[model samples]
Target: VDVMHAAFPNKVPYEIVYDRVVPSMPEKYKPLSRREFLARVMTTLLVPEEKWCLGETKLFLKAGSSLELEDLIALPDEEYGEALFKHLDLAEKKMAAAKSIILAMQAFVYRARFLRVRRGARTIQRIWKAIKLRRVWRAAAERLLEERRGRLAPKRE
Candidate 1:
């Protein structure tokens, strides 16, 4: 194991030669043969597809680095928690941005609606004033026609 560690600082051999890296746990209590120990480590601790790859004669870590079994067992819990915190921080930033966008959209909609209503009101006022002016002009024209007709009529017989 030490030789492999020295030779390939970032890789581990999957062969029985490097099997001593597996530490005995409480359940086993008994000493494990090199093959058994390696099998246990591969099955129970490392996910073959994610953490490491099965090369022809070696296991290549996906992380591009390898550590002793002790380090592997100790680091993950803390690291996973830290990763979650970082993700949460990113999620919060995304949510805040989304909220800001929503608020801006709402403000834009409100302003558009307000301007439309104001325009409608002004249009209504203009139409109403035009109608009143038309009525007044029609009345004046009727009066002028009546005066002209009366003046042109012959005196009563």
Candidate 2:
């Protein structure tokens, strides 16, 4: 309810959404009211229907629900944000090295007048060159976190 209120501040109810909003949706979509959307999201998207209940004035999750943010943050796992950054950095370096090799091979193929081979090499080269660039933002975030953690650690003689 809080999320819904924040998203739609004017307070568009289920009834209004059913009568007016649903009908105006694009043809490819099956229109569902705000109530239906909430029901589906809570039950199907977030968790099973048994995990949550629709009360008279609000929707509440059952006790011991994993849907709670605290529970989500409590789970022990690898720092995936850092892992992903490392993975992407390695990927970019590999891609750059591969591009250099492919370009050299492409020139060799062109000199030999291998039309089909050159065409394929050009396609591969273009794909690697056109790949999206990323700055490994997670590395910086992790470095900041480590600095903060170091400050909080106990110092020994």
Candidate 3:
């Protein structure tokens, strides 16, 4: 695990990512081995709203604590689909916040783009500020969800 961590620094999990994702493989998806690599990618891409400082990609490494998403992840199969849908709704709400921020910044930029040069400059500055904020918030949340999704995934790889 340390070897893999040394190689993949910011992307490696708590040395147990392989352990957890491995045992959860449902019978149908038991053919995966090295496929655990995908889990790391998913963690980087999917988790959002986790604990992160601005521009931080590796929350665990930065926090100096082992982060476990499996503890917070719950998979509601067909029998629990209702709860799953509710969780999806919650996710939508979170996305809406980010979307609105981006949209508002776009509007400001668009309106100023062809006006006065000073206005355009200010707009561009604001746009950059908004983008930085978005990156921080979005990446943090994405990291959270992706890290947590290990067990909630299809279980069969």
Among these predictions, the greatest TM-score belongs to 1
What CA root-mean-square deviation does each model show from the true structure? 14.3, 32.0, 33.1
Model 1 worst lDDT run, 10 consecutive residues: 17-26
Candidate 1: segments with Cα more than 4 A from true spot:
1-81, 147-157
Residue 17's lDDT in candidate 2: 19
TM-scores vs. true structure, each candidate: 0.43, 0.23, 0.29
Better of 1 and 2 by TM-score: 1
lDDT of each: 0.57, 0.50, 0.48
lDDT of 2 by residue, 1-157 (tens): 6544333222223342123324334342245444554464344333666565544444555555533323322433333223323433465577799999999999987877887778899999887665522235566778989888889987656
RMSD value for candidate 2? 32.0
The digit string of per-residue lDDT tens for model 3 on 1-157 reads 5433443334433333333444434443345443333333234334432432211223233332224333222433332333323444465576898899999999999877757787879999999999999999999999989877965886553
Q: TM-score of the candidate numbered 1?
A: 0.43
Q: What CA RMSD would candidate 1 show?
A: 14.3
lDDT of 1 by residue, 1-157 (tens): 6434444334555533232323322234236654444444554443453454444565555444344443553445545334423443465577799999999999999999999999999999999999999999999999999899889987677
Pick the winner on TM-score between candidates 2 and 3. 3
Give the Cα-based TM-score of candidate 3 against the true structure: 0.29
Please report the candidate that would top lDDT against the real structure.
Answer: 1
Clashes of 3: 15
